[model samples]
Each structure stands twice: as structure tokens, then as C-alpha cells.
Target: MTDGLTLRLKYLCGRYWRLLVPVLVLLSAIAFAGAAAGVTSDAQPQQTTVETDSMTVETTLSTEATVTGNTTLYEQNDTLTNLPVYLRSATPEVRLIAVTTTPPDRTVSVTQQIVLRLSATRNGEVFWRDSRVLAADSTNVTNGSTQTTATLDVQQLARERLAEVRAETGNVGTVRVEVETIAVYQTDAYSGRTSAATPVRVTERAYELETPQRDQQTNVTTEQQTAAGGAGGAGPLSVSNGPALRDLGAGLGGFVALGLAALVWLTSRRIGDFDTFRQRYERVRYAEWISRGSVPATGRHARVPVETLVDLVDIAIDSEKRVIYDVSKGVYAVVDENLMYEFRENNDGDMNEFGFVPITEPTESGSTEKTSSDDGAETAAAADSWFDADTEPPDHDSDASPDDGS
Candidate 1:
């Protein structure tokens, strides 16, 4: 029995040997592949970390400044307070007469007169100074007159003298005068009061001679000729009674008269035309027609009623009186004078006749019925009663004919 069992076991072992060999080979190949993969993973390259040095820098800046100034100028005198001394001439009619430190010539002394009065105040007391400085030509003077008069020629004085007077008196403000009086009255006197006079004016007196009269004999001759002409022959060719001159005069007069008539006729015609045009253009209907054609039809399918279209341009009614057009079927319509005046007085002169009115569609019976349904039962009954009263019932017995008559 042992021998038989050994034989069976050997047979079974031989049959399975082929399969076991392939299984063992596959296990060996998987082991080798796993080992190769493990080796490759472990031998892979690694990244390297490199080290570098860091650097820093510093800088500085500096600045400097310098200044210097020194100059000198001549100073002016402060004796005068620089206050303006307004110098005004005696009259605006006269120009500058003369300005001088010394007296002027004889030719310079006839045109203008300069007068001066001087007074002084020392401490708290007041005293009158030099009262008179007469003209070089004047001889009468014995003092105590508080006024001095000096005559000077306007064109004879040098310009330098005027400048010196202006600078000394500080008359840079304004210069004005009446006759010949001091412009600046000294309110505070004392500490060396001083003033220089500068004359300025316009001369108004006439210097030319009058026109001479003609001799009596010459005047008489001219008057006799003028009288003779006025007595009979008054115009050109009046003494000559020739046919040519008469005909020419008559023709000129006729031409002038005809020209005047023509002018009058033309002006009247123009005025009439303008009146007509204004009446036509100023009417509302005409203006609208010219600007837009006639009023549009009521709708795309609706025809505009002839009466309605005509009524659009027709005059409005107000009371029972009818205002008809003065001209029948005329394009231009003018308002009656009385009506125009009344409208002007009442409506502030506006002539607008045709005003705007809105167009609306008529309500349908179905809509009225729907509206009645929406209203409460009480309102519907009241509406029905009102409608029944407004409408009369048709007579049914009137349509029946009499039997005996038939």
C-alpha cells in the first residue's frame, strides 16, 4: 500500500511541476523589478543651495550761501512838506498871462492883471505885510490899500519862469482863478510863510475891428435896380416876352405838376396794397392755411365735413346778434371798426379770433352699459329713470288702419 501511494504522489507531482516553474519565474521577475525601482528612487539627484554676500552703501552732501549790499543816494530837502498847493487862475476864459521872477516888457503888460495880498502871523498875533505891487505902467499908489495889481503879457514870459514858480509854490495839484486873488489862504501862518504866484487864464475880449458900412450913393444905386426889377420884370427872361421862353416855362410847370400827381398816385396805390396784404396775412385762418394747408381730416377713413371745415374759419357767436363779414366771400376779412375798438378795449389789443379746442371720440352704448353695470343697483335704477324720461315711446295704435274706411 505504501509503494502504491508513493507512485500516485510522484505522478501528481510531475503533472503540477510545469505550473509551479512558471509561478516561481514570475515571482523572481517581480522581486528583481521591485529591487531595481528601489535602487533608482534612492539614487535620484538632489538640488544644491548656493550662498552669496550682501552689500550696503552710504552718501552725504553739503551746501553754502553768501549775501552782500551797500549803496548811497543824495537826500532831498524836507523844508516843504510835499503837500500840494493848488494854483487856480482868476478866470477859465483867460490862459496863462506871465510867470517871472522879475517884471516883464511893455508888450507883455497889456493883456492880463495880477493882484496880491500878503499877511503874516507870528506867535499868536496877526499882521498885514506888503499890500501893493503895482504894474510898471501904473503911477497912482500911496499904500494902505490891501490889494496890488500888476499887468503882464501872456506870450512874452519865458517857460523857465513858469517852471520855477510851479516848483516853489508846489502848485502841482490844480490851478484855478477868478479875477486875481491868492488861491491858498494861510490857515496856519508863522514859521516863514511863502507863496509864488503863477498866472493862467484864457482871454475872452474881442480884438478885431467892426465891419464898415457902404456909401449912400452905392447903396442907392443897388436899391433902384432892385426896385425896377420888382416893379415889372421879376424873374429871368421876364423882360424878354419871347415865345421860346414862355413855352419852356409852361412845359416845366406842366412837367412838375404831372410828376407830383404821379407821385401821389403811386403812394396811394402802395398804401392800398399794403392794407390789403395786412388784412389777408394777419387773419388766423389765412396764416394757418399759408403755413400748413387746410386743417387735417378727422381720421384716415373719416371725411372732413364741409360745414365743419367752413365753421373753423367762421366768426364766433356770443349773444343773439350775428356778426357777418363785411365783404362777401373775400379772402381777406377785416373786423368792423366798432367791433375792433370794443375788442381792443376789453382784451388788451390781442386780435386772436380762432382758439384751440380738443377733439374727443363719442362714447359707445356698450361702454355706457358696462359703466352702468359697474355702478351699484341703486345708481343703475336712477340712470334708467332719467333715460326713460329723456326718450318718448313710439305710438303703436297710430299704425292700425280703420276697418270701415278700408
Candidate 2:
């Protein structure tokens, strides 16, 4: 059984050697890709983080006010402190604070300040603006210090600015009023590294020129970032994961397989089936004599089968007739008196031949007379008579004859 299988395999390889070429090339490419992937995955660099000492500075903003009124909602000496919705009557005091933390055995000198600004904008453009340095301080710290505070009386400042702007413009039509505070901190570390932080708060309130109106809204404008710097006073450290081994292998295999598939396709296109090439070559060579149509089945003539198209053409030339080729049936024929000489390409060894015996009848002279039962007999007789007459045959001997060409 092994010997028989070996022989069968050898026969297939010999018969289809062209197909094996691309298969071998693909296998080689896959091997090379796998090796390359293994090497690259081994040599790939790993990610790691380095540790060192660093410093950080943190800051916050707050508010303080005394609420005094005769109404039930407002009481005397009632303090309104910290975040939003502070009563505009309280004359809210805005405070800025900062703190610094450093590594062990390190000291940092800090300078902090709070700044206040009052502005009015018309059509989104600032028309009147004023700024004041509400408070400033300096300190040195090894760990962190208590609250570094600077205060601004925002309600009083906004009231004064509103009166001034209204008086200058005669009427405040759709003018937006705003009060803002900025807390800034600068730090100088022992290693000569310096850093700064600026956090902002904005306050908007409704008011008349002479009276503080409804409650105020305060918002922290800066996106809070808790940590400032990386270790060793560098920028923030980052680490990323590299490609996994299995993923690398799969990607390499896919790329090589795609390339090999393309190669196989090109090879198959360039080197086509030998028999199909012969058929196309014959068609092109004999295109002048060949017409695309169906040939009728012969029943009144003896069939004489030939091997190639050249034999059929030779027979047609000798008989002084044109060749009829049926593309659907893959047949070429030339009809002479009682004989139909046929030629067909044996592509799969199962092509049918025109082999029907002639139809005959007894005449009164006791002799056999061959005849056709279809109306095609009249057409054939007319065509034969026309060919025999002075009507010239087709110009079958043109310079593009298949005899001297492919």
C-alpha cells in the first residue's frame, strides 16, 4: 500500500509540477516569517519606571462673609463662608491659599499672592476692567506650612465698579459684570529647581448700582491637578506595554500568507492551462474561416473523425468547401457528397462524434436511394448547386491562412 501511494504521489507531482512551485515558495515564506518573529520578540525592549525624589505644591480658594439682615432668611452677624451661593449682602471676602510638600532632607521657599479683578463686557468684549493685589506673603518650608491666605472684599469692589461703569456709559444695556480671583504660588527648591502654580475662581452676582442684590455664584475655573512633577524633578514618568509574543506571531504569519496568496494568483494567471492556450491560439489563427454558429446533427452521411483542426482545414480545402465550426459543441466539419469529416478538441476524452448511419429508401429500380427527412436537405442542395456554378468560393487562400501560421 505504501509503495502504491508513493507511486500515486509521484505521478501527481510529475503531472502538476507547476502547481507545486507556489506551494513550496509559500512554505518557505512562512518558515522565514516565523523565525523573524521569534527573533524580534526576544529582542524587543521592555518598559520600566525609574524612581527619584520630587516636590509638589497644592493650592485652594475660599470665601468668608458676615450675613446681617432683618428678614427671617437673613440674621445678624451670621457668617456665610466657603463655596458657592454666598449672600451678596455679606460683602463676601475671597481668600486664596497655597501649601508646598517636598522630599526628605529638602527645603523649598514659597511666595504666594491673591489677586482680584472686576470687569464689564459688552458684546463679549471687555470694555472696562480693574485689578488689585489683595494680599501677598513669602515663607520657607521643609514639609508643608499652614494655610497661606490672601483676601479680597469682592462684593464691595463689584458694587463700586458697577456704579462707575453706569455713570460713564449713562446706561448699562446688556453689559455682563464679573469678579475673578487668582491664587498664585512660586516655589524654589534646594536643588535649584523652580515651579509655579496658578489657580483661578470666578464669581457672578446680580446687583443694582446702590445695593447688593441676590445670592452670588462662585466656580473653580482650573481643572484640579493634585500632583505636579515627577520624581527627580523631571516631567511625569510614563510606561507602555509592548506587543505580546502570540500577537506578533499571528501578525507575521498573516502578512506572509497574504503575500504568498498573491504570488500564487499571479503565477496561475501567467502560466495557464496548456490545452486552453492551444484552443485560443487555434481560434485566433483560423478566425477568418470560422464563424460562430451551431452546426446541425448529420443523419444521412458517414462520419469521418480527424484529430486536429489542420486536418479538417485540409479536407475542406481539398473538397473546395468552407468549414462549419460549432462553438457550443466544440465541433469542426466539412461536408462532401455522403461523408461528414469532423474534428474536435479532446479536452476531457468524452466528446461525442457524429456517427449516425445514412437514411435510405428502395426505389422502383430495386436500388437504395439515400435521402434526408428534414427541410435542411433543400438548403444543402441549393448551397451545393450554387458552389458548383460560376459563383466564386470564399477567399479561403488569404495571406492569413492557418497552414503557414499557428
Best by TM-score: 2
Candidate 1 per-residue C-alpha lDDT over 58-104 given as tens digits, one digit per residue, 9 for 90 to 100: 11111111111121221222121111221112111112122211111
Instruction: Please list the residue runs of candidate 2 whose C-alpha ends up more than 4 Å from where it truly belongs after superposition.
Output: 1-20, 23-27, 30-34, 37-56, 74-76, 90-106, 150-155, 158-161, 171-406
Clashes of each: 17, 0
| lDDT (10s digit) by residue, model 2, range 1-406 | 4533433343344345567656756665776676566445444443434333344444444445565534356577766554345545544554444333433354556565545555556667777766666666666666554344555455665567655665676655333433222333334522332223222232464222211111212222233222322222222222221333343555566566657556555444443454443343344445456543345567777889987776777777788876775534556788787898888767622211111112243434577644344533553343333222222223322232433222
After best superposition, candidate 1 residue 326: deviation in angstroms? 20
lDDT of each: 0.27, 0.47
C-alpha positional error of residue 268 in candidate 1 after TM-score superposition, expressed in Å: 7.5
Instruction: Give all TM-scores, in the order shown.
Output: 0.15, 0.42
lDDT of 1: 0.27
Q: Itemize residue pairs with steric clashes in candidate 2.
A: none
